[model samples]
Target chain A: MDSPNNDYLIKKINYEIKKRNIKKVPFLEIRNNRLQGVVSSGSDIRRVYVCVIDNNNNTFSCHTNNNRKCGGLDTQYVCSHLSALISQANLRSEEDEKFDTLASTTNKQGDTKARYPEVFARFQHYLKYLQMEATIESIPEMEWFISN
Target chain B: MTAKITLKENDHINNPMIFSNDVKLDQVFEIQHQLIQVFSNGFSKLNSKGIETLKEINIAFSTSPLNTLISEAITGLNNNQLTSSNFDLLAIVMASIDGSAYDSLFDELNKLMENQVSLIDNAKEINYTSNTEDHENFLESIKSWLIDLAIMGFTEINMDVLESFEQVMDTLENIPELMRLNVILRGFIEEITTEIPITSQDEFPAKRWLGLWLRSYLLTMQLPKENVQSIKDCKLKIIGVQKYSHDYFTLYTFHGILDHEGNNRLIQIEAKKFTINEVSNNELLDLLNSTHPELFKGLEENLVIQVKQGMISGNYLILEKFKTTTTSFDIYETLAVLFESKTISYNKQNPYNRHPLLLKYPVLCKIENITKDGTSKFDWGDIPIRFDKVGTLNEKWKLANSKGIFGFIQFDNGWWISPVTILGDKNQYIGYTYSQDRSGKNVYEVLKERSNAILRSKS
Candidate 1:
C-alpha cells in the first residue's frame, strides 16, 4: 500500500472509532505471526475476534458469531474499532519512548519514585523485562498488550 | 480609684420615628406647651396643703388628660424636641401626681428619654444641638422639685420611680450645676434610704426597685465603705461586670436572698466614669487579693477569661470570665461529631457506591471486568487520589489509558462516569449494562455501524 493510502486508512479507522464512541481498547496480543484482539462494534460489550496481518500494513479480518461485521477490517474499508486499536498502538509506542527518556534522565536520582510511586512501579516492571534481556522482537508490537 | 463614666451609644432603642429627619422643632414645642397646660390645670386645683404636700389630690379628674398630655410630650421628646423647659415641667408634674400614676408616667418618660438619646447617638447626621445650659437648668429644677415632693410625702412612692429618677441623674453629670446638686441629691437619697427599711422580705410595693436604687445611689456618692456594707447587709452577690466602654461598666449582681415578692432578680448597676489601672492578670489578681479578697472566693478554679476583642472601631476589649468543665469523648463520640458536622450522602443505586467524601477524594481504579453491554467494574488499588485536587480525572484517565490496551474506569462518584469503551471521550454519557453475556461481537462496532446507517439513511 502507498503511504497516502495508509494514512487515509488510519484516518478512516479513527473517524469510525469516534463515531461509534468506542472507548475501551479490546484485549490484544501477538501470537505466532498474527496480531489478534477483541474489538467492540459499538457500545455493546460483545466482542469480535480481529486478526491482523503483522506486516506493518492495514490488512486485517474480523469474525463474530453474532452476524456483526466491521467493514474497516478490509484493506478497502475501515471501522472505528480497528482505528481505536491502531490509535492505541501508536499511543503505546509514544509512551514507551517517553518512559525510556524518563528512565535515562532519572537513572541516577530515584527521586521520581517518591513523587510518582505508581509510574515508578510500572517503570520498575518495564525494567524487569529489560533485565530478562528480552529484546523488542520478543514482545508484542503494542507494548501495552497484556496476555490473558 | 476615681470612677469616670463616659456615656456610650445605648443600643436598646429601635424607633424609626425618633430617627426620622422630618420632625419639626415647632411640633415638639407644641407638645411641650400642651403638657405644661395640663400640669397647670392639675396644679391649680391644689390648695396650699395639696400643693405643699404629696397627698392624693382630686386630680383624679385630671389624670386621664395628664396622661394624654404626657404621652404627646414623650412622642415629641423621643423625636428629639426635648427642650430644658419640657424636662423641668415633666419632673415637677411627675412629683406631684399620685404615687401609682406617677410611677407609671415616670417609667414611660424614662424609656422615651433613653430611646431619644440612643437615636441621637446612632444617627449619622446629628441635627440636634446639645444645650449645656438647658440641661443644667433642668437638673437644678429636678433637684428643687424633688425636695418639694419629698416634703410633701412623695418620697414614699414606688422605688421603680426612684430608679427612673436615678437614670435621669446619670445624664446630669455633664451639666456644670451637677456639682452642687449632687451634694443635695446625696442628702435626699441618704434620708430616703434611712426611712425605707432594707429587708430581704418586705410588704413594700417598691422594695425591689428601691433596694437596687439604694445600692447604686451609695456607689454614685463615692461611699465604697458604705456601699460594700450595704451590699453585705442586703445580701447581694456580684455576678459579673460588663465593660461597654472605657468609662462605663455595668456591674451585674443577684440578691443573695429573695425579696418579699419571692423574686431573686438580677440588678444591673451602671457605673460610669470609672478609670481602670494598667494591670496584667497577675497584677489584677494581686489587687483583688489586697482590696477585695472575698470576691475571688466565689470564682471557680477553671475560670476562662474570654476576651472578645475588635468589637468596636478602636482597640476595645470585652473580657468575660466563665467557668469551664473538661469532658472527655470516646471513639463513639468522635464519630457522632463527624456525622453531625460533615454532610455525607449515600446512594445505593450508584455504580461507584461512593460516599460524598470518597467522591471528594477520588481514586483511580483498574477496570476488572466489562460486560458486553458496556457496564464495567473497577478495582481501586491501595493508592488514594484526591479527585478535587486532580483536575478532570476523566481527561487524565483518558490520557493514561491511551498508553495501554487494558481498559480503565475514571469517574467522579455519581457526578459523571467515563465508561471503558468510550475512554477518550470522557464527556459522553453512553448507558451502561452489566450483563455477563459475551456475544462474541464487538458491541461498539455494531453500534457504530447502526449509527452510520441511520446517518446515511437520514442524509
Candidate 2:
C-alpha cells in the first residue's frame, strides 16, 4: 500500500480539531512523512514539529527559537496527533473487516485483532497522565510552573 | 536547558468534581481524605476492636522509605549504645511519639522500664517457668516490630495509600498463631474438602482473614491443615493436612454439631500434625506406652489374623515346592484394595511397601462398604481408567479423558486417551472413540489443528 497522504493527514487533523470542539484550532502540515504544525495559546504562536519518535516508538517533540521558553503546544499536539491517527486506523480496519477473507483468516476465533493497537495507545496515554499526576504532587506551590 | 515543573492538564481537567493541584495544601489534604476513606472501608469491619485500634494509626508522608527509617533508628540507638539487644525497639518508640505530650521520649522509656520491671527481671533463662513474663516478652517483641515498621516512612504526610505499613503489621500480629496456620494450610486442604465450598457457608466468617494469616504463619510453623474453614469448622480439611504431615499429632472429633450435645455416636479419632522430632522420638514412644498401658493387655488383639486359617509345619516347605501357581489376573487389584484400606501401612513397623514419607498422618476412613465409589471403602478393579476400552483407544480416544478418569490426553484424531494407552507397543493410541464431530471436522483433524482451537474449546 502507498504511504498515507500528507495533505489528507493535515485535513484529517483539522477535521479532528473541529470534531473535538477544541477552540483556537491549529494548522497541521506534513512534508515527506514528517508532521509540522503551528499552535498558539492566545498569547504566542509557536512553531512545532514532531521530528523524532521517543524511546516508546512514538513521535512527539516541539522546537523553539533563541529568545523564548519551551514549546507550549508540544504535549497536547503529540497527544492529539496520536489520538487522530488511532481513530483513522480504527476506521480503516473496520472497512477492511467487511471482506470475508480478511474477516476469517486474520480474525482469530471470530474476534477482530483491530482493537490491540488502540488499547496500547490508550495505555501509553494513561501512563503519561500518571506521570503528570506525580509531577503535580511533588513540590510546593506546583501551579503549572512550566506553563507559567 | 532548565527544568521546570508543571501541573498535568489531565488532573481535574476532565473531571469537574476533582480539585486541581494549583493549591499545594489542597492536594495533600485530598490525598489524606482518600487514604482515610480507603482505610475505613477496607479494614474497619474485620474485628470489633478494629475501628478503635485503627484510629491510633499514624499516617504521614515522608521522603524516606520504611527500611531507611528502620536503619536510621538503629543508628541512633547505636550512637547511645544504651541497650544493645532492644536498642532498635527503643529507637522506634522514641521516634513515633510525635503527637504525644513528651519533649524527650527518654522519660517514656523510663516509665516503660518501671512498669515492666518484673518482665525485665524475669528475662533471664532461669525464669522461663513464668508464663506471664513470657507473654509480656512476646507482646513487647511484637510491639518493637510494630514500632520499627511505623518508623519506616510507611506513608506520606498526605496519606498516599489507604492503610499504613504499621497497620498492616499490627493486623497480622493480632491474628492468633493458630488462626494463621489455618489460613496458610487452606489452599493445600481445599482439594480434600470437596463436600461444599467452605467459603460459601455463613458460619465461616473468618475465611479471608484465615487465608491471609495462615500464609504468614505456615512460613514459621509447618503444621498440616488443608484449608482455613476446615480448621475453623474442624472438618475433613484438617484430616487432609494430618494425612500430609506425618510427624505432627492431630486428635479431632468427627461429628460436627450434635456431637457437642448429648448424642451417642462413635467418634472417629485421627492424628493431624504428627511429627516425632529426633530429640523427642524416644520421649513420645514412652508417653504413648504410659498413656495407653492398656495396649499391653490387648497386644494379642493387635496381631494380624488370617481369614482362611491354614496349618502347615513339615509340609510348608514341601507344599511350597510342589505348588507352582501363577495367577491370570494382575495382583494390583488385590494390592489396590489393601492400599485404599490403608491397612497396608508403610512405616518402620512394616517393610513391604517403601512409599515416600510425603504425609505424616494417615487419613483413616470408617469402612462403610467395600464396593462404593469415592467413599471409605475398597472398590477393587474400578481403576480410574478402564482396561475394557484398551484396544480401540486411538479411535475412541475421546472416551479416555472423561472427567472422572485419572489420567487423560487428547489425540490428533479428536480422540482423548489416558496415559495407560502407552501400553500398546509403538502405537501408543491404542484405545478410544471420537467425541461427536463439531464444526463438521472429524475429531482427529481438530485435535491436530493449531493447539489454540482445541484449548479454547476446552476452556
What's the lDDT for all of these models? Answer: 0.27, 0.23
Give TM-scores of chain A for all candidates: 0.38, 0.25
Residues A28-81 of candidate 2: C-alpha lDDT, one tens digit per residue: 222112222222233432322122222222334433212222333343344343
The true-versus-predicted C-alpha distance at residue A109 of model 1, in Å, is 68
The lowest-lDDT stretch of 10 consecutive residues in candidate 2 chain B is B235-244
Q: TM-score (chain A) of candidate 1?
A: 0.38
Standalone chain B TM-score for every prediction: 0.21, 0.19
- How high is the DockQ of candidate 2? 0.01
For model 2, what is the alpha-carbon lDDT of residue B94? 21
Name the regions of candidate 1 deviating beyond 4 angstroms: A1-148, B1-83, B90-241, B248-273, B276-289, B301-459
Report model 1's TM-score to 2 decimal places: 0.18
Residue B82 error for model 1, in Å?
9.4
> In order, what DockQ does each candidate have?
0.00, 0.01
Distance (Å) between predicted and true CA of B227, model 1? 16
